[model samples]
Target chain A: MTADAAVVVENAEKWFGLNPALANVSLRVHPGEFVALLGRNGAGKSTLLRVVARLVKPNRGRVRIWGVDVARDPERGRERIGLVAHQTYLYPGLTARENLRLHARLHRLEGAGERVAAALTEAGLNLSADRPVRGFSRGMQQRLAIARATLHGPELVLLDEPFTGLDLEAAELLSERLRQWAAAGRTIVMATHNLEQGLEGVTRWVLLDRGRIVTEWTGDSTAVRSRYRQFLKGAPPGAQGRRT
Target chain B: MKGLQKHLGLVALLAMMAALYAIFVLAPVELTMGVVQKIFYFHVSSAWVGFLAIYLVCFCSLRFLRNRDRQWDIRAAAAAEVGAVFLTLNLVSGPIWAKPVWGIWWTWDARLTTTFVLWLIYMGYLMLRRLVDSPEQRARLSAVVSIFGAVNALVVYMANRWWRTQHPQPVIAGGEDSGLHPDMLLALLVTVLAFTLLFFCLWKMGCDLERTRDSVESLRRTAQRHLREVR
Candidate 1:
């Protein structure tokens, strides 16, 4: 809840029936902090990111975005967050341009038409902007999703498994966009299973296991892959795996 | 708490049986409709519970939109499902009673038609949920539909007054001369109370089943992840 902290989760715990999805998880992100959240499948990566986005509330504890308590004032918290989830969150019947325009209008962006056009161009979707999103490939749809998430120019970006269906080239392009966003002082928390891809351009790395932050590294991506591998090996056999 | 739930279930069952006995044995048979009038007790009660369930869906949908909490979405879905069940009973029982009393199986009366439309809307809502793969999208779309259906429920309740129809006027609100007899009203009240309790029990069971289904899906995904890792 600090004034400078872009995102803060305090002692968050979430359970679905008998299964605990997130347990006593707490983390904080500051301005310009690009945190790459790495974990094996079912390690609570997506749940933690959702908690930050306020899409899912924790059974116990609180989350704050940009110094506003999410549980107390969800609308304000939502206004400051841009989330790119597993689904593209776009209408397939609408053209890419139309989709972005809808999001822009929903966010009450100034000069929505111009902002949407700029987003389409920035995402390299200008040429296919008029075509229905249903005709786009997975990679193209993902680029549009990224464009949509950033359309509002939100201060905190939360991405869950953004690279799940992307090609190497598309992923590289997205990484570059993320780097540019981070450079502009936006805080970002990304959840990914890709060890190597997640390390690129990230300022900090966190590894979660069984709903807890087991290890963290800052300032250098050189040894993160090896360290992550060793960490995964030491994790329980049930916890070390890729998402289906 | 578990013991309380079990006892509550038993109490609801016993009360339902008592309500049935009062409807069949205690309440006097209608001079005009004879034995077929017995359906009125449970039919009207089911319709009342059905409308109440849909209202709950609307309430939970609004809560879900405001908070974006999955629990509200779950509750909305469960309510809609239970509402559909009760609505189907109302619709089916209406036709049965009409066949014996009105000498016809069906009619496009104002109340009957609007109630059918309400049923269709909720059925469509359930189908829309099934068609959407993404959980967030499903919840958002269904919430919108639930809100619309709730507004439609008001229309259905008012349809008889707004238009001419063969359906009987409201017995409870039928003005000074139109109220039910004391015995019949007592029977209807008991049936309504029993059905309301039954609605809660079914709604709770539905929510529990949904939660269990979600947990099973998560476990299956985790197992699949483990299998992939082994390869």
Candidate 2:
């Protein structure tokens, strides 16, 4: 966490038609912080994540990744960031190897074949790496999604509900690897509904409601667990809202 | 939107209309076919603009795919839409002129068939754009399709001439371009110039409006999400 702030946002505002998805939203995360963005279904968490990913532009605001303005210079900044969302973002028709190859080429990686193979192995998907993604099971596809996101060893990793359909064992394995990812000084920001699963190894917890930050808290494991329980008990009964 | 800009397209239209007016009404009727030759003015002008617009679409689409720029996609779409308009007029007017001159409204002649094939391809290109959702994807797919269409346009144009072109070829005859009488060529040149100006004006407006609409739509989606959360 000593290198620098991996992300910084200030007075961000985003609108969809007449509705405001994000209003005056701002936050800063240092390198290696495993932050969890928790919110109800319509919370602006997804929007803010994408705004930082440079996948979507903000109506009014400033967002910088590794000190580079994402909006002003997206390609330059995007080279340092990785994202996995609800959509696989992988071409369904292409084989996993081809999909990874295309993304690798875009990232300008030189040894794409060797790196793609290693990523597939890391995701426990080596056997299926040559198969088209259309045939992959949900959990299997998600693993490949992670592999794709990390293909270039991005500094900032943004995951939206990474554990959505995984079994308990698979979730544990991913959680363990994610902890190792953070320990190695990579920044991780995940948006998820499974509070208990996401709370592990989190350096900070931020709650969003209706596209606005209701609270942000940081602490040791015990405090975060207690606060997470209280937040869930007090919130409305539904999946957290998505920003964007 | 200002004075000169607002009336620019209209001025071009007026100039073309004037040339057409003089060519058809004031100029002496062709000795060969009397008043029937008057259809040649609009007939050739529309075909010229249509061909030029489609070619522009091909060029812009190629750039769009290579650079992944939104502006090129907008230009391609505008060209395709306008080109289709002019091509339809060309197709219809050709028949109108032919029915009286050749005593036939329809023919499977090489020139006519080639034009028809090109019309179909451009129509298909427009349809393909409508089916795509992402701007990036649209640009990629349209670039490939437009290139294919461009090749088709060239093929059709050349194939008609190489084979026994059933439809009469106007530009070249006996391997030499028959020089149009000075008045007739001047009128034709003026009409083509006018149509080119008109196309440019219309294309500018079309591209401007499309970009605005995209920005507004993204804004609207964000606004809707905000409202739901606030509620």
Which is the leading candidate under DockQ? 1
Candidate 2: list runs displaced more than 4 Å: A1-30, A37-157, A167-169, A183-185, A204-244, B58-75, B102-114, B135-177, B204-231
Model 1 alpha-carbon drift over 4 Å, by segment: A12-21, A41-190, A197-202, A237-244, B1-5, B59-80, B132-144, B165-182, B197-231
Per-residue lDDT, model 2, residue B179, is 57
Mind giving the per-residue lDDT tens digits that candidate 1 earns over A15-101? 644457788988988888999998888899998988877778787888988789998998899888899876899899999999998
Instruction: Report per-prediction Cα RMSD to one decimal.
Output: 6.2, 7.4
Candidates in order have lDDT scores of 0.84, 0.79
Clashes, model 1:
0
Model 2 per-residue lDDT tens digits across residues A1-244: 3126789988888753334678889999988898889887768888889889877677678998888888789998889888866666788899889999999999999898899989888888888888999998877777777788889989888988877767676577668768878889889999887766655678888888767887888876677667767765553434245422
Provide the TM-score for each candidate, comma-separated: 0.69, 0.64
Output DockQ, candidate 1.
0.11
Find the 10 residues in a row with the least total lDDT in model 2 chain A: A235-244
